[model samples]
Each structure stands twice: as structure tokens, then as C-alpha cells.
Target: MGDPAAQALCAALRDRDWRAARDVLVTVTDPDDQAFCMYAAGRVPDVQEWIGEWADAEPRSTLPLLVRGTHAVHWAWQARGSASASRTREEQFREFHRRLTFAENLLDEVAGRDADDTTARAFLVTAARGRQVGRDEAHRRFAEVVARHPWHRLAHAQMLQYRCAKWFGSDEEMFDFARTAAAKAPAASGLAHLVASAHLEIWLRLRSGEDNRYLQQAEVRAEVRAAADHSVRHPQHGRYAGWPTPHNMFAMAFAVGGDHAAAAEQFRTIGDQVTELPWAYAGNPVRVFRKWRGKVTDSVA
Candidate 1:
């Protein structure tokens, strides 16, 4: 039977009242629901506590614990300046390893299965492992998954495009690829953002280099504006919202088009709302721009 407390918590969350959700979730007797609720409420400390309680009560339920534990670890890392953060980080890492071992055992139990569940599990494992190791390897594994199941092609393509954007030097080639990918996967807002980002990057590069291609600048700005507008209207499903990429892109386009005051206002808006770790973008354009902004400004000056 479903826990009544959990049901209440779900109802509260649906109403967007996190405080009520947290209170109800903490009262729930079910470990799974407790862990999920704590995560939804962004209550990292409570999540860690629930993970420990759940792990001891049911050792086999490791995957959910691990997912919650990862969130705890991420939060703990952000709390690095706190006195207890180091110990919390170490504890979370140990739990992560335990969860990984359990996941491996679970996979072994269903080895050779051709079921969709197995494929999904494999895909998640690959993506998680990729984050832990190298982006290139992660993209390679994602590509394999898509090849086996074309239904996942759009997601894999977005990941690959992110990898290319972060590590590759050839802007024209990357932009071409992004344009094609975006056209092929019209439903994927992430790919659409990448397409817009590629154009923005080209514009940034040209402006820094004093390339007087004003016609090209106008075209790139229009393309980026359209993509950003589209992404704002149709964000990718299951992706984190409120990213400042589109805002930053619009600001950049305005700045390049001699709208300094508008650009400054946009930048201020982004700077005000940009949290330290709101979401993870493997090949985030805003991060890249921030890292190189000083150098670009100096060169242009």
C-alpha cells in the first residue's frame, strides 16, 4: 500500500509548496518516497539521513539510494566552506561506491537480456560513468546506445554536440553539425540551444578578431535569436529550467549589434540569478564565454 504521508507530500509538491512537501515527506514511513521527496524539496541534509536509513533497512534498494546520495554529494561539495563538509563528502563517496557495486550486481543478474529496461539501465550506466571519467568516452558510449536504439538518437546527438563545442576548435564545422542535428531533431530543445550557441560563438569570435562581416553578424544574430526564443518556449523535457544561456546569448547579440545598454542590462539580469550550480551543462557556452571574456575584451580593446 502507498504511504498516506507520501501521497500527501506528492500533493503538496504538485501545488508547488515545497515547505509543506518537506514536512509531509519527512513523516513518510517509506524510504523510497522519503528520499525522492527530500530531493524534490532540495533538502540535502534530510536526503542524506534518509539514504542512510533506507540503505540499512533495505540493502537491495541501492540505485535510488545512490541517486539520492549523488545529489547529497553534489550539495556537500557546494558546501565546501562549511566545517562538516569534508566529512560529509567522504561519507557520500563511500555510499556512491556501495551503490555502484549494487548496480553492477543488478546488471549481472539480468545479463544478456534484450528488454527495454536493460537497455535503459545500460544507457544510464554509460552516461553516469562518462560523467565520472571523460566526456569523449561518454559521447562514444552514448553513440553506441543510440545506434542500437534509434529512438534515443536526439539525446545522444545533443551530448555529442556539447562535447564538440567544449573541446573542438573548428567553429564552422561544429556549427554545421549543430545546424544539421537541430534540423533532424526538431523536438530536442537542447540540440536547438546548441545550434544557437554555435552561431553565437562564431559572432563572438568575429567580434573579438575585428572581422567586419556586418552582414554575417546580422544573419548569425537572427539565427541565435530564433533558437533562443524557441528554446525558451519549448524547453527540453526532463531538463532543468532557468538556465541563463539564452539570456546571455541575447545579451551578446545585442552588444555586438551596438546595443551596449541593453546588453549590460541583460548581463546584470543573468548575473543576478545565476546560481553556483543550478544545473550541469557538459559543454556550456555561457561558461566558456565567461572563462574567455576577459581575454576577448582585451583583444578587442
Candidate 2:
């Protein structure tokens, strides 16, 4: 959610001003922010009831259903069982499927009412992927969303996850999508981070220290550099709704590729901000970040 929107929504909710909150929500133009607000609002029963009442008042509005679906899928993904209980995993998967089914149905309803609802289409991609829907169905839903909003960061990221080998997609397929998506995105749009995301996925799949060798490959090095220059070094580069993570991904890639100077620049840009992703794959995110940040910072010193 946009910081301003989040703040306004929080204040309205605190003041029990449902009408004001609804007004604030209806004006949110960013699909990702809209979905996030719905997810956050879904946490409160009273807020949900207010949302349901709003939906009743405006049956044609897809916002309520879209929020509900996004919230359900977000909740379902967190249903992972405890590590010690094997049966719990099975139970969790069953419950996950049930919740996903409900979410998918809600999204489908929204689609039926408004085929052009980009947010709904994006959630459909997520819902289908989570339900283990076939690659073809997953791709179809993703295509529907990206076809309408080519620069959608969240949609692209979700599709990247869908195409990951761990999710029944091969590395070749994942890289193909990542490259194509990156190429289609404008340089300043920061969508080129899709390639960094793909590289991270490929690295995580390798055993032990092999990822270092993989990152050193000629082709990988070339692609990573091109993406970095376009999205991270471009004069037009600026902050987006999703910033720092992309810069952090590039920083990790450059560090692994042994370009300490380039890596150091990225770290300087990132400053104290850090994301668990890509780094988390290595170990404790904070420790991993410190290791790389130290590696480059020390070189300059």
C-alpha cells in the first residue's frame, strides 16, 4: 500500500470512520496497493463486515471481491505445517487447496463481471499457481494480466514464481520468461529486475557452493551486467513502489560475480535497506547481507 493511503486508512479505521476509509480506498489507482489494503483490511472482522456492506451497496464493484480473493490466497500460503509433524503438512495442503478454491472462485466471479480488471487477473494468476493448476492454465492467467498491464511488477514476480522449477517449471522456461519480460519492460520501469530474480532462482537450485561457479559463467555474467546497467545504472532510474529489493538483488549478483567495485556501488545505493529474499537463500539474511556489504566496503577502505 502507498504510505499515504496506509496512514489514512489506519487513521480512519482507528477513528471508526468506515465511510472515510471506503472513500480513501476507492481512490487507490495502484493495483498492488489496492490488493495490499484489502489484505490488511481482511485481518479485521469488523473491517470485513464493512467491506461486505460496501460490496452489497455496490454489487458491480470488483474491488471488494478482489481484496477478499487476494487476502485468502495470502492467508492460504502461510498455512505451512510445522516441521516436526508430517501429518500436519498433509492437513495444511488440504486446507490450502480448499482456501485456494474459494479464492479462485471469487476471482473468477470478478473476472466474469469485469474481464478487464487487471488486479483480479493478477490474483487469478496467483490463485491458479497456488492451486497447482497446470502450467498452461497458469500461463494463460498470467498472460491475461500482463497483456493488459505490461509493466506490472507484482504480476511479473508472481509469474516468475509460477515458472520456477520448484513449481514444476524448468530453468530454461523460467529464464525465457524472465528475459522476455525484462526486454519488454521500459528501462526506467525497473522490470529488468526480472532477470536478477531469475538468476536468484537458478542459483538457489544449485547445490552448495556451485552457485558461485554458475554466476561466473560468461552468458550469466553478460546478462546480469546488461540488466544491471539498464535498471540500476540508467540515468532515469528512480524509486518505484518496489525499490531496494531489485538493487539488493543486483548487489548480491555483482558480489557473487566478484566485481567488488560494482557491488559496492549497489550497496551504497541500497544503504541500510535490506530484503530477506535472494539473501535469505544463502542463510540468515542479515548475516549474508553483512558478509557481502563487508566484502565490498572493506575493498574500498
Candidate 3:
């Protein structure tokens, strides 16, 4: 229903065709692409029921393990629901930790079995967040991912989440991480999304009216534009498989930042594509996407 690979993998899982799913996954070598595939595949319903069988059948291959581990994160979140910790019940918290620990164990096995497995290492960054790993430990896990794949987008994004104000880190830490990564990243890559992500996080953290004010700040607007230049606007930026994410991210950032014209540009590039993230953070995915989309294009609503 989403990415082509995701659809194929989802179909394979529904049909209990692990072999076909493996075939679709094995072709993807890049860390970003692999992570994207995993993200989509992990969201499919009833995966936990059969994913274990795939893991058991392929004792040698880490692909099944990776799939299971990635799905575990989704499973953990589902158990916990989307409510803040204060709102979550004790039972949900316990189950969240239990599932996260399971995910951590599988990811740890993959990384240990193959030291250079950036995909496994990237998912570890995610597991660390739910597990509430120590700051130093989280840094170590993230470092392992970037050491193998310096521009590992999933790893960076996951690490940013762990360091967000809503999580372990504070606002200063979040901006520092985002800006430093964008500065070090090579042009044309989408590292700049980190900056947009940080801004979005901060905006979401504030009170209702304060949230909009934060995004509307002059400095915030300038940085968001600069981030756009570093990514979507860069001439060398080619449309990759997950291209819609960055466009949608920057579109949301600009839309909230009171730059309707810039928002329009990103919205144009995005066209009809709506990624789960960036919008899902605000409200109902499709409704929120179309609201801002209508604001910019006067066509989506």
C-alpha cells in the first residue's frame, strides 16, 4: 500500500511467502533503502505471528532477524500506545519494555554476528530509545552505525529522536546534533532533514499557541530555508526511493513556519505523496496532510 518494496514484502508476509519477501529485501543494499523497506514491512499486521518462523528458518542470514527486530519496535510502540509515559498504564509500560528488550536482543545478535551490519546497528539506535539506554550508550550505538554508513539516514533520525526534548536530550542537544550533522554531511544527501526534524520537535513540544510562534520565528524560518538549500533545493539532489519524506518534512516545516510560498514549493514536489511521519506527529495522517496541503495548493482538501 506504500513503497513498492513494502507492498511486495507485505504481500509476501500476508501469503506466508517468506522466500519471496527475502528475495525483495536482499536486493536492497543501501542502508537508507533497507531501513525504509524494513519500516514499511514492519507496519504490516500479524507479522509477529510468522516473522519468528522466518528468523528460525534462516539461522545463517541476518535479514529475518533484522525484520523481526524492526517489527519488534513497532510492536513495542503498539503495546505502549501513543500516549505520553504519564498517561500509559503500568501494564503497557511493562509490555513496551519487554518487547523492546526482545528487539534489542535480536539486533545485538545481528551486529555481533556481522560487525559491519549497518542496518542492525541503525535499528539498535531505535531500540536504545525505547529501552532508555544511557546517554553514553546511545552515542556509542549511533557511532557504530555512522562509522559503517556515515550518511545513514535512519540511524541519524533514530538518534535524533532519542536526543529529542520529549525523550532523553534537551533542546540545546537536539539543535547541536541536527546542525552538526547537517554541516558535516555531504551536499545532495538529505541530512538537512535533521534540522527540520529538530525544529518540528521543538514546535511540537511547546504549548498550542507558543508552538506556532516558535515555528514563525525569524531564525527558525532562516534555518529551515538553509536546511532546504542543503537538501531538496540542491541541484545534485536526485530523487531516491524515500524522496517524498524530505519534501513532506520540509513542507510541514515551512507550512508551520509561515512561509506559504516555500511550503508551496515543497508541497508541489510532494504532489500526492504523504509519508506517515511529519504529519502523523500532528493528528490523523490523511486529514493533517490534506489540511496543510490545502493551505498551500488550495486543491487537496
Candidate 4:
């Protein structure tokens, strides 16, 4: 079955056995299996042959191409050496936007027949964009989707992450929602880590001033550090690996903690990495630095 083959490929990827996974994926005729295979190929180094083969064979399919597009974005983001890294960053951004738009359109096509899946996938596509623009809009859409399908863990997790960063409501409300979402997510997949990291970012911001009450919450600080450490130890644990959020969050934390130099260094490490496919930079280094610089200046002034 496609699920088993997909699982096997995921396992192979986890074990770093690209060759075997590629071979295993080659025999799968199912669309989902093929998509997962393409996803795996995109992760491996020097697999142009595999990527080309899959891309050429399934250029129109949203799932496989989405995987390829994300990988391409990762490559582009990583290749960006500096802020003035020329037109490539812009090009990659356009490409990711195109893919995300295509995925959104595809969701419409399947909506009538499989509304739940359509909503779930659409949530993923839009949540990726939540990092760029439309934070509030994305949150609204994700909330609607999750309301319709409460079991969609990814969408719920993403909604929580977006809210944490956007600070949708009071600190108490955001903290409560974030803690609940982290508790609900499966531990192995690292959704918990993702949500917790977002919480940590907010916590760091709230604690920027000595008078902040949440600064004394040892549990929050401990959770944030733990999430960051977990993410660092397993970068590829989630759907979108090499995304700049974790790195940017780490930098933001350091910046807020009065370590401007450390924050700058963290941002610099991600300066070269291309933005993730879907081009979610709602929390990218450029934006993060812009915000951090403002905060620093405000603190000094």
C-alpha cells in the first residue's frame, strides 16, 4: 500500500539511507507514494537525477511538486550568501509563491469531494505563508479549518505557532493556548518543539523588560530552551526542515537577553540559507533583525 511504502521511505530518510529509499520509492505507483518518494529525493544530496525524473513525470501534480518546490526553496535560501544576494532571492520567492498559489488552487478542485483533506492541506499551504504576510488572515483561516476538523494536528499546531508569534490576544491567553497545543502534539514529529519554540520567542519578548511578570516563569524558559535544543538536535524532524524560524527564534531570544552580538551571529548563519519554499519569512532574519534593531534602539533610548 501507499501508506506502507511512504512509511518505509520516511524511515529510510530518518536512517539516512537515501539510496535504498529512492529504490523503494521507484516501485511505488500510487500518487501519494510517488509524492513521498519525490519528497525524499529532494532531501538527499546530488539526487538531481531522481528529482528530474520525478518532476518531469509528475509536473502537474500538486503534492509531488510541492515537495520539490519546498526543497528548491531550501536550496535557494541556503545559497543566499548575503542580503544583497542579487535577484536569486527574489526569483526563489516568486517561485515559492507560485507553487503555494498552485497548491491553493488545487485544494479548491478537491474540496467538493474531500472537504476535510482539502481543508487540512490548504491549512498547511497557508500556514507556510503565515511566516510572510497574512499572519492574522492565516490564523483566521487555520482556525476555521481546525474548527471543521479538530483532529488535524498540523493545522492546530500551526495555528498555535502563528498566534504565539503574532500575539493574537493577551499574554495569559496566548500562553494557555500554546501550552495546550504543545501537549496535544505527537512528540516524535516535533510539532511540540515547534509550538514551544514559538512560545519561547513570545516569552523572550514579554520578558525584554525587567518589570515583565512572565520573566520569572521558570517553566516557560525551561520549555523554550528545551524546544530549541530539540530542534537543533533534529533539524529535519518536521515537514519543513532548514526553515529560518528556529534559527531566527534563537537569535531573537539572545537579542532580547541583551546579547546583540550573539543575535547578529545567529541571523548571519541563516543569511545564506534560502527561504523555505512557500517563502514564509514571517519570521525570517531580515524581518527579525528589523524588529530586533528597533527593540534594541528602544531599550537604549
Top candidate, metric TM-score: 3
Candidate 4 residues lying further than 4 Å off, grouped into runs, are: 1-96, 106-137, 143-151, 166-176, 180-195, 203-301
- The lDDT values for all models are 0.45, 0.75, 0.86, 0.47
Of 1 and 2, the candidate ranking higher by lDDT: 2
Candidate structures ordered by TM-score, highest first: 3, 2, 1, 4
lDDT of 4 at 204: 45
Cα error, candidate 1, residue 154 (Å): 12
User: Could you report the Cα RMSD, in angstroms, for every candidate shown?
Assistant: 10.4, 3.3, 2.0, 11.0
lDDT per residue (tens digit) for residues 174-290 in model 3: 999999999989766788988998999888878999998999999999999999999888887777767788888899999988888889888888888888888998888789989
Residue 121, candidate 4: Cα error in Å is 1.5
For each candidate in turn, the TM-score is 0.43, 0.85, 0.95, 0.42
Q: Rank the candidates by lDDT, best first.
A: 3, 2, 4, 1
Model 1 regions lying over 4 Å from their true place: 1-50, 58-63, 72-136, 144-162, 165-177, 187-190, 199-216, 233-301
Clash pairs, candidate 1, are none
lDDT of 1 by residue, 1-301 (tens): 1235535654654454445644564455332233333333333334434444444654554333443433443343344323343555665655555554444444333332333222333334333432354656555545545565443433443353444544432665676766765566544333455665565455444554463254136675567556544554354522322235445545555455554444455555566443222112213644644643433344345
Question: Clash number for every model?
Answer: 0, 0, 0, 8
Cα lDDT, model 4, residue 56: 62
Q: Where's the lowest-lDDT run of ten residues in candidate 1? A: 274-283
Error of 4 at 82 (Å): 9.7
